[model samples]
Target: MGTKIKISMTAISIIIGFMLAIQFQTVKKPKLRDTRDIWQLREDLLKEQDLQSKLIEEIRSNEDRFDKYETKMKDSKEQALKDTLKELKKDAGQTKVTGSGIVLKIAPFEEAVLLNKRVPEVSPILLNRLVNELNMYGAKQIAIDGERIINTTVIRDINGETKINGRSINSYPFEIKVIAENIKAANKLYNRIQVSPVIDELFVDNLKAIISKPKESIEIPAYDSSIIIQYMEPVK
Candidate 1:
């Protein structure tokens, strides 16, 4: 009976020692609690709001850049098409041009008139030759009697009369305006025509080709007639 009492007392002492150890650990390391005041919490909230606002602004900036890029692409395509159409019209002689060039006045030769020789008509062959020579010497545009000479221009005699673009060239002392690419080009054309044998050839036909000095600005009217398109169609 004494031994049983001694064992119960030892068990009670062990239980007390375990309970004291748990209490000592609880005092050494207590749970942490938030000590921040309401003001500090409000400052943190404002910082978060500012970050969110910055993020929204960045997104809007990116959207604006994308929109501008798309608009520029569309505008560039439209501008390219406009430029191409303008170039086509210029090539077709449908637009009036002004540049440096020279002029030619054709009339009866003075010597032929003095000699009382019958003044022959301006032959189509001589006119064609003169035009070919002028084209070879960098003549960009040519207008004979106010008719613009294009790629489809025909100079043929009909009924013993010379007609240009269905208009009669029966009168003398008419003007033939020629436009060059630039002032230097006009000067070059003038020098070439001065030395060309075509001038003498015109004299032989009793026609005088009086060339003028290169001028700074010479105007050439556009082709006034309709251009008949043959064997060509627009793409679908």
Candidate 2:
């Protein structure tokens, strides 16, 4: 009976030893694999952080370059616009200009008016004809009675008196200033106007048209009237 009891105790001890070995192996394998996994995860995390830092620096650099480029473009555009405005002002007669040209004087013949018993006021038709001839002869800028003639200028007979831009002009004698493109053009304009039929027509009306020879320099004042556009649009 004692031998049987001893054999049973040995069997129990062997079974307990086997079970402890299996549990220990299972826990140790998992711990080793977890250590490797943790190290790999840390390496990956560090690499990702480095990439993120590089991307941030690149973004900052791009923003700085963009700011500089934008400023340069803005400055360039502003300068271009300023130049265009200056040219436009000159062409629109918003500024004074000087060039070689001729001056024309119109006056009523005092003796003829008394003899013919007719008023010697210059007619709008006669004035318009003279202006058109001057333009044809290369007259660049023209002014009558200190009023600048622009594209928007209007001349009409308002209430028995010849008016320009809604203002009455002098009756007997008035001056017309003209600016030509060049000295040659001014001479041609003067010669052509001196012998034009317009002068003959004026003479028939008991008025005298006298033109001066080409001057070295003539100054034309800027247009003083407002330029208002009522109904005009540009096509695309």
Candidate 3:
């Protein structure tokens, strides 16, 4: 009776161990890793790879866009050159000059003109006439007391003070540089002028009228002030 009871107990212990081992291997092992957790790991890996590819493609596209922008910028700069030239032409206007040259220097008016006595000061009409006659004789650039004339301008003696191109004139010896067709003709042409006795008598430091062909460059600075050509505007 004692041996039978001992054998039954041993059989029950072995069966219990076998059943627990089978549960760990077949049911508990698969249930421990949930379906949601496995699916999340797969999605994370795919997202990481796709993000890397998108970053690389974005870098390449930005480089191409930058190159195209640089080319457009270059073309814009070249196109701006034409506008610059047109501006230069309008500012300087046009000059008609031929062959060689002559230079006339004007000294200060006599004390009567400067003192504002009963005598009239130098007027705009006289200066304009002189300029017109010089242009007719083919002067290139006309300068009054070192100020260059671009647009049609006036020089006037205001009371005792003098002004040229709407600004005050400072120093003495007004000058005119002519591009002469006939060098000898300048001497003959100037003699014909019916000028004031006081004007004809006035003398510059370098008094003689000079007619010489310019071999070197003659520099005349453009007018410092801007001129609006109201006559040349388009109708509104």
For each candidate in turn, the TM-score is 0.66, 0.63, 0.41
Whole-model lDDT per candidate: 0.85, 0.81, 0.55
Which residues of candidate 1, in runs, are more than 4 Å off?
A: 1-74
Query: Candidate 2: global Cα-lDDT?
Result: 0.81
Q: Candidate 3, residues 1-236: lDDT per residue as tens digits?
A: 99999999989989998998998788756755455776678866754775676567659866875675567568795645555555455336433333344556555445545665343333455566666656543454566655667756767776665577767654444465554335554454344332323234333222223333342334444566666676586678
What ordering of candidates by lDDT runs from best to worst?
1, 2, 3
**Model 1 agreement with the true structure over 1-236: per-residue lDDT tens digits:** 99999999999999999999999999988988878999889866854775676568659966875676567668796765666567668778999999999999999977888999988668888888888778767688999989899988888899999988777788878899999879998998899888777889887778888899999999999999998889999999
Error of 3 at 167 (Å): 2.1
lDDT at 46 for candidate 1? 57
Consecutive 10-residue window with the lowest summed lDDT within model 2: 30-39
lDDT over C-alpha atoms for residue 54 of model 3: 55
Candidate 3 has an lDDT of: 0.55
Predicted structure with the largest lDDT when compared to the true one: 1
Which ranges in model 3 have alpha carbons more than 4 Å from their true place?
Answer: 1-100, 108-123, 157-160, 179-216, 231-236
Off by over 4 Å in 2: 1-75, 113-117, 232-236
Number of colliding residue pairs in model 2: 0
- Better candidate by lDDT, 2 or 3: 2
Per-model clash counts, in order, read 0, 0, 0
TM-score, structure 2 vs. true: 0.63
